[model samples]
Target: MTGDVWAVGDAYEVYVGRWSRRVAPLFVGWLGVGAGRRWLDAGCGTGALTSAILAAGPADVVGVDPSRGFLRSALDTARVAGDAAALPLRDGVFDAVVSGLALNFVPDPARAVAEFARVAAPGAVVAAYVWDYAGGMQMMRHFWDVAADPEHDESRRFPICQEGPLREAWAAAGLTEVATRSIEIPTVFASFDDYWTPFLGGQGAAPAYLATLSDDRRRRIREDLRARLPAGEGGEIALTARAWAVRGHKTAG
Candidate 1:
């Protein structure tokens, strides 16, 4: 198994952070939590969702992630080095507990969702979003389709990214009013180089796999992607990314 590498914050920003930022506001807005509520951004890689929560006038927001390197790039907010499955925070302390684009990467997503519930106050919203890798996340779907390796495909590796699994996880964690939706955003690359260069950064699944390939094989894959991706006359490649977002409320005590 080719493990995903996420140490380089700059590389991750280019690869997926930009798109995750686009999804953050939408996910936050969907929650519709009122101003002045405390928020906990579990698995808050580089603070994409944490920044969005801040923009919503929260009383306070704390971001927790295992990546210290990524934390350095996060916005000025309360941050802690922690894992999603086992957050280093007091229980029932937050009005909103959220994770974005990070749930699928967790080794045990059910445990993480339980932690989300544990940290959330009664009636608090516990929500998360993950890239729809199997179908709607075109950026990754294109890569895996061209890469032509089912073993390396994230869709196969992370079945919990889908709607059914997400809702089930939330419900099993004892959350109520569990619901799921798709958040789609435009991913327009300035050119083929813009799209291809990020894959060479080796920050995520596809790039990690690419790093294991021989130079000649890498060139072949790059050329294949260049030929396959739809480019306009202006040399812009427009694609879309979709994330399945799940939201639920901790039962009021």
Candidate 2:
């Protein structure tokens, strides 16, 4: 749990890929991608963003992530296993460069932003989004409210996951017409168990922290979240997942 959870690889693609589905379309919709254009999906975990981009009718798409396993699972796009700050592709060839729910995890978000701009052609769009972990990301908020470990708080480290930081980062990367917005999607769980089971997978920050707890403590945390969640008809627990998205165009020289 102390080390990087992504080191295990593929576990995130399995669990996170499902969790992110609710918000994926919102992220892509904000992008307003055009048909028959090339795209670079940086930090394209399990192809969620890439798949969304494909559905938007891009002529071609390239999916890149640090996890080879994730790239393996990516849909028909050209997949690259590489770091976000140092993409393996050439510069200014893509019509658009986008990332979803991954900018926070990059070693240097500003550098990643710069890379996104670098790989984009003049007049190309550059966009990215990350979960608003401090407020609207209900699933993680529930887990952290129970766990209450400052060191393990995902929101604390993700400085650029909010609108302000996103705008600033985009500007600093020399992108123009920068704008930001929030996207909220519904996450419905069949039962408390449906929500709790994924925590045991040890994929993201919350699950990794949950994995570190003693069995008794884990039980207490589970009960805490279960008691707090607002269950409705058919024992369903509906929660809102929110992400902060930003977009800008590379300057035409």
Candidate 3:
């Protein structure tokens, strides 16, 4: 991958999650930033929520991710490492399991969810947040706006964040009492330069774009983004990011 996956993950460590920040309003809200005593954070990226979980009062957290680079950043905050699909932990050993915007990225998110449920004790709460790609993920829509342009084939190169197939797969994984809802968090950027600089870093789909662009094409993209963003009354547009929250309980054996 032209994108340094680790660098990309690390870049996000400083930047907040547009979608993952909205974990508070969904029905699974109990599993808030600190809902578990001993929590397992599956697909925990850069450790934002994992760090939040620890502060929320968990004794110890095991944050897992597939990226060694992302995990490197995660280590700065918590005990984060490894894969979510096949966690290196024991069964029914966790009081709560939380995943943040990670389900869509994994190859088998369902199996990963099942793994999360398995490690959680019976009656333990399993919670996660996924972006609503088809409906409400605004930042994603902004990304697609550029990627979908005829001047670029960026969509094909970047991964799709479609929500339907993922949710169905989650259901197939035997996560019962599954309930979902949308939560919105406002993203505020200080200026166009602040927003545009991250794109130049080329760490994510946005960065993938910079790698492919001719100088003119790159400038056009940058300009297009700048033109689209309205100046905030308070120097920031209160952009709303949407994510779907899902929760299920492990059945008592």
Candidate 4:
């Protein structure tokens, strides 16, 4: 989250790529969580997932994130946004809670979990998903393959993307009946440009490296990435990607 090349709002749409889209639909289906009375989506980013929850049948689906720029874009996209740790909503205000591909990015995932538990009605469900980076996240593997040097390995910062540790995180948050699943989703790119161009713009991880690349070196990097992919006769790279999802129901008394 440091560095000048980073841009998250609309400037960073691809930051949430086909993978997020591919994963969102699954999070909704596996959640099997009805619309309920109300739903809260924490770390909702630009609110795509929030909108999906609403469409699934919830009378209300509120999206909360800490970034104003992101929220502004989220509102433009027709979803409400607020803080993740201190949601602006009232107490016991939701029937079920959800989050898609968000927890791993949070600095204090535990506090965020406590906040979801606090806002949900007793017996309501709180469910969320994170990319299993160590075990199944593939796009990062692309970057890591190209970027792993003696001084840096960006993937290491993401410990929660692994399943067992993520489950422990839920337990530590006091959520019970915790269950986890490994869901596979496809991440397909149209072309080499479609795959590698997004990175040169310096959006997320790619940008970090892009900023360090000189013009000739950047072009060389692009060529290198292209060579790794299958040639254009309907070339497809199957992202053996996954979403490590976990859910727990609040105790009913």
Best by TM-score, which number?
1
Give the TM-score (vs. native) of candidate 2: 0.94
Alpha carbon lDDT of each predicted model:
0.93, 0.83, 0.63, 0.69
How many pairs of residues collide in each model? 0, 0, 1, 2
Give the alpha carbon lDDT tens digit for every residue of 1-253 in model 4: 3443323665456754446766777777776776456778887777767666656674566777766666776644335556566677776777788887777666677777888888888888888888766647666666656654523344576677777876886787677898888888767777666666667565655467666867887776667666765555777555567778888877776
229: Cα error in model 2, Å? 1.2
The per-residue C-alpha lDDT of model 2 at residue 91 equals 86
RMSD of each: 0.8, 1.7, 3.7, 2.8
Ranking by lDDT: 1, 2, 4, 3
lDDT of 3 by residue, 152-230 (tens): 3333332323445445655676666666656776666677776667666555544665667698988877787777766
**Which residue pairs collide, candidate 1?**
none
Please estimate how well model 4 matches the true structure, expressed as its whole-model Cα lDDT: 0.69
TM-score of each: 0.98, 0.94, 0.80, 0.85
Ordered list by TM-score, greatest first: 1, 2, 4, 3
Where model 1 places Cα greater than 4 Å from the true spot, the runs are none
Residue 195's lDDT within candidate 1 is 94
Q: Candidate 4: which stretches are off by over 4 Å?
A: 1-8, 75-82, 150-154
Please provide, for model 2 over 72-180, each residue's C-alpha lDDT reduced to its tens digit, 9 standing for 90 to 100.
6678768888999999989899998989888999979999999999999999999988999898999888888778887768888687888999999999999999999
Cα misplacement distance, residue 91 of candidate 1 (Å): 1.2
Q: Local error of candidate 2 at 125, Å?
A: 0.4
